[model samples]
Target: MNANNIVDATTRSPARVDEVLDRFFSLSTTRAATLAPAYEALWKTLRSNTNGGKRFRPRMVMTAYEGLGGEDLAAAAHVGASFELLHTALIVHDDVIDRDFVRRGIPNVSGSYRDIAHTAGLSIPTAEHRGMSVAVIAGDLALTGAFRLMGLAETNSATRARLLNILDDAVFASAAGELIDVDFSLYSGVPSVEEIVDMERLKTAVYSFEAPLQAGAVLAGAPESVISALGKFGREIGIAYQIVDDLLGVFGDEHATGKTTIGDIREGKRTTLIAYASTRPEWSAISHLVGKSSLTPAEAQIVRTELEACGAKDFTERLAGEHADRAVAALADGNVPQRLVDELTPIVAAVLERVR
Candidate 1:
């Protein structure tokens, strides 16, 4: 399929996307209001954190629904909104774990709470502790809200149960992957590329792509074979998405990406690019640059250059393409409606091509 066809097929109506967001925030606000004022402060933090994301997970859910011959836009919107809620919950907790200060050009949940406390004249360490505490509870609330939304969706009980199961399992698997990621970070030992790929699949793929697609398909009353096929497709695209994200972390424009260029290296993330570069003797200088946080911009550039020189970037890009191809192929195998397949082709392509 051509790009325009793909764009038109998968591109959600702006009004529909807005409706999903409105429903989500309205639910979030109502649920949050029942809490104490301090907890409400955390709710506001959650709201801010979730406000400006690209809505990628929700969009994926809706696209999959459309791909499955689902014509009920309202139903698709509910499924999409559920995924977005779950995603926001995950992000709130993730930022706390990563101690990430910034997200989408704004202070993250924990950071925003910290700033609020600081402005109130709390001491630095005290403010940080309070903020993190609130963020943790707020994240829990968001997670609960995700389940509530799913329960309230206008779908049959069987479909609801299946989607909820998938969401729960994906969350557990993603958490396990995050733990492994933390373990890898703390240890000095380098993991093999194969190992890194495994980590990426669990940490990023299943939750970000597979679960959302499966849930959408289930909601559409798709056959089991079709749902399974979409899951396989989602796994491939999701992994590619992470690989591309890793590439962008090192090589993308900081202003657009809202991240420091090469921040992953400074943070010592064990991504596919790092794994590939470590295999090349010619890239030893780049290897030396990997774990150092004090690297100058020039040094960062040199390291990125070395990564390209060692063919890491090219290899990663090719890997993404292979996954995209696999996703397209899976679509063909599922006996999916032609219209749905047509929409998905470009979305898979866009996932591979996204700069941020």
Candidate 2:
């Protein structure tokens, strides 16, 4: 099979999942509308915020389900939709953690409320606090909404329970990872490369890759060995995915990523790149600028230059390639079908393709 065709066919943001999400949002807004107009507005804002994603997580579910020869596309669709909901919930809370008001270059739930508060004559600090408060509520709603979506899947109680457990694992691992990520910034010294890798794996790899793939396998009723192999592949690829994302966060086109490159630098996130850079003598040149909130574009440019000069970019690229290679190697497990291997192989390259 043409890997590109398979990818396009399998991963085009399934309309079925979108329909499920649409119905979910509609019912949610209707219930909220009955209570208060502000509640209705909150749901509407969340609905807006959750739109325009690539829906990769849901598609992963379908991919594994179909690949493993499972029928019941509708059941897979509901489970996949739940993963997407979980993704939205996490990112909404992540934005709040990052103190970001925008997502996909638009005003996020927090940003929308913050702007409204500001226009209503609230002080900037007050407006920001109000925005964060509303965003927290919005995030909470999305978090619970994810489990609710899972419960909607037309599957037996046993299978549904397993899926819920998988989702809970994703949520649990993600929270641990997010906390570690936050704590890294508070350290007086840069975290080790190993520590950074572990943090990245927990924060993004598990939920985005491992859980989705495993969920698909479980939904398909695959054997334990195949499920284990997919989890390994997903975990490795997910690490590479986040590494490339970190690369993009510092050096990529804002239009392509729909994110500001400088934000990571400003936040002083102890990414692998930063961790590696700290070991280099050149890092001292721009050390003071790494975490400065009011960092100027020119200053950011200087930091970028130092990072490049110190070979941090090159090192990070090599690290991502290593993980990608390991991800492909994971498919060699005898239990994994060759057809599945071929279709999934392209994803490793695809993960690193964005930074190139």
Candidate 3:
């Protein structure tokens, strides 16, 4: 299929998934009438935060389901929505950890609360505390909502248990990875490429890719071999996704991405591209570009140029292609249905080619 067709398919998948999420959000209000005011605030915050995401995780779930020959689109969509809710929980907590104030062009949960506190004439430190408190509670609410949605999804007991197991494991692993990431940022020594990849896999790959695919496969009653094959495929794609994101942090259009360019460099994130560049002998220019309090647009451009010259961008792109090839090969070798392969092949291609 062409790129446009792939976009259309992916678009359709998210719309279906969002519809399910909307249903769940509406149902969440049934108890709002009887709940305490604080509980009502928590639920509303969770729902609002969950609604603003791009639904990438949910798309992954639905794509895997369709690829595995599952015809129950509604059930798949509901499962995808559950994943989205889980992802929202992760993001809300992650933003708190990162002390980020914005996401997708709006004040993040914490930032919104901070704004309200500031409007009420609170001291700056007190406002910050109020924001963080609300964010922490909102994150917990989102996490609980994720499990509730999963339990309410239509599926067999066996499938439900399997999916839950995968989801639970991914959540735990992701939390550990996030801790490692935060610790790494605070330390001085840089880790090896293998260690960096391990961090990426644990913090990102499994939950971002493998678990979603596995959940869909379980729902579809896919064979063990097929599920395993998809797992490998998802891991590779997930890593590439992170690499692309890292690249965008330095070079992408800020308007398109809804994030400040070079924020990763400012935050001192130890990404694969950074790891690779730092190991090279001619990395002085690149090294100086990162780990700064702020970066000027001209400086960011120069850093982007240096990154390209050092072959970091090319290397990342090549790695993404390698993973995409592996994903496609797995589908072919595992005898997965052709229609699913056709749907995913272009999606993988687009992911590798994405600029923002």
The prediction achieving the highest lDDT against the true structure is 2
Candidate 3 lDDT, 1-356, residue by residue in tens: 01232354463448888888888777776587477776676677677887756677777788778777788888888778878888888888988898876777688889988888999999888998888888998888778877877776788888888888888988988888898888889986666666777787788888878888878888888898878877887887777677677777777666656557777776667877777777776578757767777677677777777778888777766766777777777877776677667766766777766653
- Quote the positional error of residue 334 for candidate 1 in Å: 1.9
lDDT of 2: 0.86
> Model 1, range 42-78, lDDT digits (tens) per residue?
6666776667556677777887787677887777776
Ten-residue segment with the worst summed lDDT in candidate 3? 1-10
lDDT of 2 by residue, 110-199 (tens): 899999999999999999999999999998898898898888788889999999999999999999999998898777689988898999
Instruction: Give the CA lDDT, 0 to 100, for residue 24 in model 3.
Output: 79
Please give the distance, in angstroms, between residue 48's alpha carbon in candidate 2 and its true position after superposition: 0.8
| lDDT for each candidate structure | 0.76, 0.86, 0.76
Q: Which stretches of candidate 1 lie over 4 Å from their true place?
A: 1-9, 14-24, 27-35
Residue 259, model 3: lDDT of 57
lDDT, residue 222, candidate 1? 87
